[model samples]
Target: MNDFVTVAVFDYPHEITVLKHLLDQAEIDYFFENETMMNIAPMYSQALGGIRLKVHPEDAETVREILKKLNDESNLKIV
Candidate 1:
């Protein structure tokens, strides 16, 4: 397997999904980790859960920036 760069971890499935969509919309590639955690134990997963959004090591920083942008947008929507 290739080395992956973890960009973000979100406990909420909605958040994880949203982030995933954002990356897709941005045309940035990513992969997920901890998918079982989202379904097996939702409450626990939400409390201590999250999906690791990963990309190629070379695109790590770019992925992080995109995550930051999505996070900021998510936060603003909450306000």
Candidate 2:
């Protein structure tokens, strides 16, 4: 995971639901840091710096493109 880099930070798990499926469909190698903790305490998201979407360095650009498309296509903007 050392090669993984943060590509996005979401404040809540609900915000990432569609994103998770998109990432899965794309077969991207990624993980959400602090997701478990955030799920346990959503109020701590700000303190924990949100749930980080970390992807392998090789897939960073692709992931970014995917995120862009997702944001452009839906009202669920993840910024």
User: Clashing pairs in model 2?
Assistant: none
Q: Estimate each model's TM-score.
A: 0.69, 0.90
lDDT of 1 by residue, 1-79 (tens): 2687776776756666666677788777677777667767767765654666778887788877876775575566531
- lDDT, residue 54, candidate 1: 74
- In candidate 1, clashing pairs total 2
> How would you encode candidate 2's per-residue C-alpha lDDT over 1-79 as one tens digit per residue?
9889999999998988899999999999899999999989999999999999999999999999988888785565545
Task: Identify the candidate with maximal lDDT.
Answer: 2
lDDT of each: 0.69, 0.91
Candidate 1: lDDT over CA atoms? 0.69
